[model samples]
Target: MLRIRPRALPVPATVLAWPVAVGSLALAVAALVLHASTVGGLRDTTNLHLADLWLSVLGPTVGAAVVARDRRTGLVLLGTAPIAVGAVAGAYAVWSAEVGGAPGAAAAAWLATWTWVPFFLPALLLPVVLRSGAAARLGAPVAGVLVLIAVFSAFAPGPAGPFAAVPNPLGLAWAPWLGPAAGVLIGLTAVVLVPAAALLAVVRWRRASGDDRWQLGLLAAGEAVFVAAHLSPVTAQPLSDVLVAVGLTALLGSVALGVHLRSVTAGLRRERELLATARETERLRLHRDLHDGVGPELAGLALQLGAVASRTGEPVLRELEGRLREVVGEVRRVVDDLRPAGLDASGLAGALRERARAFSAGDLTCAVEADVPDGLPPAVEVAAFRIAAEALTNAARHAGASTCTVRLGTEPGSLLVEVADDGSGIRADAGPGVGLASMRRRAEELGGTLRVGAGPGGGTVVRAVLPVPR
Candidate 1:
């Protein structure tokens, strides 16, 4: 399989992340302070105070969490918008409420006009949640339009009672033209932009999988609550405030939880990969120990037995010598069974050729065609050699074959080994034996496949493909 590397974050940007996060968090805390002060200290019973505080806290917390994990600039900016805007607006509102001069009047008017800004938080994040460049492209213009509406509504000459159901502190009046224009713009945004964003989110949710699907579903639920509260009659009072709190909480909580879950899944996958690597290393170490240490000792003992047999010619001694020779052969076979020693000396192609030569005997003509490259990974080489050995053994011992062919080759990203025997094919009622299963397991462990069936030449064919690790 081809592997694509992700782009790395630049060094300076990564180093600066913590400072930016702290700054954003500080701004969110400042917003909370202003909210508490304006609502008559910490003892305020108003629902607006509670809603504003919830938003102020949730904004920075969710932003920091997303930035720390994903490090996507777009998402980070979206996540922090609520905290920044709320901080500025809350500070202005608190100053306006405390002082009663000209500056205070202007600040109060601005606060009353732009009270809807906090409600725009989810809409601002719609682009990020939708995960589409086109949505992001369109979001910029839609956001600009919303801003224009806010500016017009704030300065418009009309008797203002409240903005977005929150009581207006400054009974400021607006111009006739400004009020109608702002009202028309707000209506257009609600009619066009909101549905567009919702449709985009739905489409993205349908296309997403795994954790993304869950995240989007939770986000949708939160958005539904937010919208329902905003569209409800003005008499809903505390109910609307409660809905806003629940919706914002659900949105931020879902994002944080999604990020946490994705991180956990990635960590578990890495652990599994590390364990597999350790097992492969240990298997290769045992192979080397047996081949280097035990094989030589057995060979030396065989030679000593040969020398003793030449000097002593008794019948019993000769029989014992014969048995000793058989034992030596069995030891050599056991060493080979533990690991293919030929793989160390030669690569996969050379090792397969050696196995093919060993299998060729009376009534069996084995031909090997190998075109594999050097420097394949050790695991791939071992799996290919073992699979070829097993297939060749089955062909020679079980199949009444006249001729056999072993071919080794490479594709773009994998090594292929095929052992085909021209003999009576496998019986229909025969069960798959351990040797065939072992071959299949080896191939699968290496992220490849092995197929056993009738060959094109009317014989049993066993083909194994092992991926070449990048």
Candidate 2:
């Protein structure tokens, strides 16, 4: 069953990203063309000609970066939509202004003023995505986007910047009451989103390692430099633009690196899963061979030995038969260890419930709440089951808890397993034992995580987040 496998994307990244990229390239090419045709390209690249350069490659590249990754498809689309829109609007602004009396020039000019908005908004989600692959919610981020649009819609700035000495076509001509709302937006952005983004970046930085660490770190770093350069002296436009260009290039490069790394990691994970599946298949085959092929033969040998022993009263034949019985017991043990008890009859959730039932007693009570779907990858299922079992065992025997709850659920691209017990909490100074270590190993082996610590108020909590193979 392909339940956990992601449906194929209707459009490939190369197909979508390339055309958009080419369009952005056309923007830069157009900016240069219009620049050479007139004087505004180099004289005022930042506002007139240079605005198109920002969108030249960076905007589309940023959009492409998010598009190439399969995770959070809708959010990625929503987050990146502004890039192309801003680019085209900026390009149109340049083209119209060059033609002197070109239609819609005023509107395009006003729209171009906010070309920097799209690049700023995705900052809200970038840190969160780096920390956790999933975006927790869309409400706040969407609201932020709307607020940005509303600010531009409601407030008409004086004749400056992209307005090009002309009134803004989008903003209301004059509205005294709109300032409070705009003030509120600015304050929230500065106080809430900025600090929150910084905090998330720090948290994500601390959590990520190896390629992940550097990739997201480079993104943060590159964007910081770009922002700093944007705020630099206007007199240093040439130097500032260079810094901005480098920073933007770095941003695109980092995302590309991340996508490449994710592809490689996913491929390796699939290979490992295939190998594990093959190994399990072999285990089952060996179990069958021993059960069907060797069992009868061993029984026949025992029967002959017993008959000879009975006829001649030979002690050696009796001893040989006893040894054969021990070998049979060992084989059965191996077969049993190959799979969890009742795992075949009952799925992961059912096995969890049975394990929960086994742990329940007068002194300790166990409960299970599960929401796992069918057709989960076998490796993911086995890992979840084992992690849950170990957690349950710890709760039952070690925690001395009155109540232990096992919760199994699914997150966007992963399985969530949590075991919380209301016994004495894990000691602050105590190190992780073999059980904890084993659970961590299992989760990490599947490209996930396990967290064991004191529960809220009291007792121990075991949390494992395991990636389900797509």
Candidate 3:
């Protein structure tokens, strides 16, 4: 059954991201139209303008979706930077287009800012995503260089600077040489960092498994197509725009697919666990019913047969009574095998202690030291007890052990049971038999593990670790 819990509304990243992208695209198209109308025709609009508009819309959409899906702090910071830059630049473009400024200067500034700035955020983040720590180390210096470039561009004086499109937009024209010098630095930094990020992504792709590889491959392909569209000669503007749009759509689609796959995988895993738990619960209930119902019936029958044997001294009756008593014992044993009574009565510790006592016989000393907390789930307790009993039995009978120890304790989020014997170590040819296999199965049924091997003191050790369900 699917359970839905009431929670506060999810952050609106997914909801906001796509609409923002579409709106940005519409605004960009509007800006282009305005420019075309003002300047007289579509022929006046540059391919660079089209490329910038697409990039500005595409970058933030991808970023927002990624940040929402991953929810990583680093990704959030990285994704937000591009969106912030784009928003400001987009607003400026609208203002410049509608209000009309130093003819084409403002439009050029908007195009340049959007074209260069939007891609930089994704490029910077790519390295971090690819090779987490190594990327961080490498990216720090690259980031510092980029920051230096920004500082230089902002403070640079004249229109010939790196940020020439929006020259002195920040009113840094007080220093002319600063802009040109920073622009050079920015170009050089991009040349180095962009290739490095791409290389890191390639390395990541080589190492990535399953869904991750697909996601990375799709992102790479989309980015490559988008970049190629911009670089290719602009023979047909409409065709170019269509191609760029297709590339961006592909990239966004991949992100969505990845998110969907992750959610489906998680849901499937939860369902499997729930199904397993249900099966176990039903098994335990059946065992409990058999123990509670049939066990007492057989015991009562044995008692009545004994009373009959005393009353009537017939040979057949006596013989039948003996056989019936054996059958009763066998029935009880079967019930205990299915689910230990001690486990039901007093939890794991009591169960282990009782088992240890039962296994203790002449020439074999069995000691149980258990500090397990009370009220563990019935399944866990039962499995742990069974495993421990089997281990102790093996140590006492097969191991030729004089001294056997059963220890029960708790580890973080789990219960630990270990049965060790100081005896002749496991024989090489003495393969795992039904008893050992049974113990292992019991442990595994409860999503736990069992290990049987030579102990530290040159004897056998049987250890089972069972998870404690909350």
Candidate 4:
């Protein structure tokens, strides 16, 4: 089994992040203030911009920086900020032509024409990146798609409302295909991208547990709000942007809480791994000390006592010698219990063969067919060997079996172990026994599975598939 090291993510410095956060907030606030002062403070325009741009764009940007587990995550959260802010501030420039920032307002107006893409696209992506593992990796590509949508919309032939009044400085009137392509992208967003993201969120939510589950739920709700505001004709009403802001706030809060929760979960997992390692190391130390030091010492003392007893003809020394021999036997048992070495030194195949031999005696015979290569990871080897051993033990002890077979093999990314005995089969309704539960735990800990049932030939069979690290 091979361990693949995680690729290190690029982390932006505090200095760089601070500038972006400040600049984004400044632009959003300036737009809101300009819109408010020019259009009346009591009007819908000012209030709508306040809820939409501030929360959807600026709010998540700042929240991610402050609460994200990594700066890279914050970067992802803020990646689409410029586009969203541009669309808002640009619209302000177009509306209030005398608003002083009109010299560059054309581009913002062109951006404003497509109301939904800039803000809603990012919202659609929140759930994917927030999941924080393989999903977090999706942040870049999705952000790339967002960029493409924005860039292509610049040349969209029949631009949205704002584009007709104000020329797109970047618009290409000759490129008719660009409009259709952008439309296709939008179509894809509606048909494929949006549905996929939603499906991914649903799947993750179903699989998630505890706090993570609810965090995803909040995220899903937030995403839904943006989609609602974008698609609905009532988007011009203050309520739309207000709900959008509330949704963005939910998104921001859920992201922070999810990152913190996942971090806690990761920390707890590491602690558990450390504890297991410590316990294993201590057991090995105890095993070695007892086997090498105490066992021989007790045996030597017993021999000396026996000699003394014979030389002096003393019954007391003889009894003491016998007691020492018994103590040595108990020590050997303790040493054996302290550690398992068969699968540790050599590979699982050999260990399993030896185990089968040990269990093969009297009325029963055991056979092994193993196709495993050497140097399987200790965890995989241990799990496979232990499961096979337990299954064989159960068969030999419980089942009146004449013969048993042990099979060890590998499937694409997993190690397979199967033990079958031709004896009275297990009851269909029988619940898991202590041994079965233990085997299941061992397999599950490695993200694997175990199944016990009637063998194809007769009697019972136990099968476990343990994932081998690759």
Candidate 5:
């Protein structure tokens, strides 16, 4: 399997990220301000530290957003660039600490939770969702629900009923073992969750797609409800042990459904994508066959007929030669109609100029103006070239065009290519010609656009604009 390189964030996103960081920093500062001015300072109550810790937790999400951005933009080729997973984990740890700016129990817990996201995000969610079929798509929502559940469980308002915690840790019956044990339990849950999710994702990706979307949804819904029950305001008991059992059962059921559906969907989507690709490949092959085999055979037969007409020197020779010439010309036209490999080989300018020159030698004129830098990304180059070729081809073959001008250059932060022809005006609704359709597809696939309309002095003009390299 090919590994995809994640991209860098866009300019707007890069700018946005710093503000999020600054906003988080401001929150910490506000915590400090509130801490000092209120009833007591940092030494008096742990709430200030807790506030700061929560603010610090926001930092890793920013970092996670950055990681997500990298994946979105195709900049994360680091999968092959010798970067170790531990290094990524360490970086997140350091970033979390720096963002925290101080150490406390709450800060530690926040840092630990925030840091867990990156590892689990890619290792767990990415594998299952991206690689899985329909289940993977549903996996995103499921994962979101789970995270929400966890957050709700962690921060749910304490002690609706009598069994809730005492105000201070010192006087509580189980404070000594309970606090540490709860922390340990959370950590252990994370350890188990990460590996289990990852393992399930891997299995699903490797499996076939007969998975049920509804079952997955039901399981997710059930877990959400189960988790909600414990965290609900109406819970009769403050520390209901029964609630824990119900939540765990729901969690176990959800996981089982997730594992099964994930495998099936992954298999299904993979097969469907493969089939689509294969179909496209077959279509291309058929096009090649018609162009290479049938078209040439027709032309060869026309040549043979022309030879017979000449050798006989009959009165019908001129008529025969004319008919054969027309046949050969039409054969050539059909071949050209079938494919435009010239555009692929020589760039758009060369192909357009060749078409223009072939169409008109004296009364018609054609020129190519190109200022493209060397080594433009191949996809961009191909798209630009094809648009130019299509415009010129349409003009010469259909529009009775006399003059054509093609230009390729950079405009602002975009690559712009335009082809204009002085010919009969084009249709308002361009017909679905293969040439036109191919040009549009090429443009769109590269995050660019194509426009064709009337030229100022009658005829048609085509333009393509694409993003410049970041």
Candidate 6:
């Protein structure tokens, strides 16, 4: 059994990011209402704000705690625990921030910052951190979600309420540091976010297996260039945020495609291997059938023919030799039927001739006509030969036919094989025997149909029509 270690994570680190972000927003809203309102609301707002801060700080700290625990305690203990790193990180981010400023503005700013941390970190490190462990699996989706949140917030209106910057009504502007300060704050936030993401990603990459590391490395490197351009001076912040959203979506799409392609390729390879094995098994089975069934039977016929030759004065000896020769030939023909070997060189006509020679016995006049052209497909040749042989044998044995005629001629866009016998007429509703049923199966296998009905002169005629190969 393959022991897949539960990815190392802190207790309570498994809270999904969306819930964390939503809960943080809810806390901010509650705190803002209390802070902005009268006496009764103020106390409640302070408590909520404090709770938010506690959560944010404790979240990531627990992750480090778990890592420490893993370092000291053992991976086995961690396996028994349900703690996950992402949940902890999300919880930590949710609870850490101070909820002190204006309601709307402070909430937007905090959400933006919190979301940015995971976004930038994962974007920067997911590719690099795909080592041999749990981190690799967690990196891409975590980072992607963070980027998505940031993109959503970028288009939202600026922070309002208590957190809003003081508005200037006069002609002269008062605050010089305000504009540049905001820009610097945004830039610094981005920088800080990148490294934190890298920590998680690098840990993951180190723990990953085989080509997984290479795949993450390639994906992460491309993401880096894209992130740099988004955070750069050349683009609008809003547009850059959108671009990040698009990039993350594309990265996720690529991961999905990669997984799908890998599965499909694996399936195709397995099928091909199975097919080769099947062919080998069939070859072995055919060799055994021919050797066990046909080989001894023909040897017995040869012995009988030798005995007949020794009994010189008897008239029955000549007939016995002829019959034994036919039996030996029939055994060889049945053995050859195991697989179609040389339809290309001998053609359908030659195969039929061999079959006729095989079944020639007393009162069975077998005539085979080979007017049909050579170079017809191998499938057609094999189908034609089997159908003709089956029809001839059925006529000679069951129909008590004195004469059998096999005609092969090419019709317009079709190849026709007609076998007619001059013997007792078939009943109007005669159910097909095993030999005729086999001929029908052979014809159908090659995209053709076989028919057995009354001949004009009180006999049975079997006809098969097959398509000309393209």
lDDT of each: 0.64, 0.65, 0.62, 0.68, 0.50, 0.52
Model 2, residue 303: distance off in Å is: 3.5
Q: What is the C-alpha RMSD of each candidate to the true structure, in Å?
A: 10.6, 6.9, 9.2, 7.0, 17.6, 21.2
Q: How many backbone clashes does candidate 2 have?
A: 1
Top-lDDT candidate index: 4
Please write out the lDDT profile of model 3 over residues 1-470, one tens digit for every residue: 99999998876666666666666566566655544544422223222344446556665555555555564422422343343334334444444544556365554443334334434545545535532545556656665766676566444554422333344444454566775676677666555565555566666666665445665665465445544553456648677666655654554455445555665755665565466577657767877777787767877887888788888877888888789878878877877666777777767787677777777757888998988887777677767777887778778777789999989889889999898899898899987799988997777666567778898879999988887877
Best by TM-score: 4
**lDDT (tens digit, per residue) of candidate 6 on 394-443:** 88788888888899999876899999998886876777677777887666
Ranking by TM-score: 4, 2, 3, 1, 5, 6
**Model 1 segments more than 4 A misplaced:** 1-53, 73-78, 81-84, 87-99, 102-235, 303-307, 310-470
**Weakest 10 consecutive residues, lDDT, candidate 4?**
40-49
Give me the runs in candidate 5 sitting further than 4 Å from their true place.
Answer: 1-55, 71-292, 298-334, 341-347, 358-365, 371-386, 389-404, 409-416, 420-440, 450-470
lDDT of 5 by residue, 347-450 (tens): 55566567667756655677888777655554455556667767777877788877888888887767998888888887777667888788866665554667
lDDT of 6: 0.52
Model 5, CA-based lDDT = 0.50
TM-score per candidate: 0.52, 0.70, 0.56, 0.72, 0.33, 0.30
Report clash pairs, candidate 1: 156-174, 156-175, 157-174, 157-175, 158-173, 158-174
Q: What is the lDDT of residue 323 in candidate 2?
A: 94
Query: How many pairs of residues in model 1 come into backbone collision?
Result: 6
lDDT of 2: 0.65
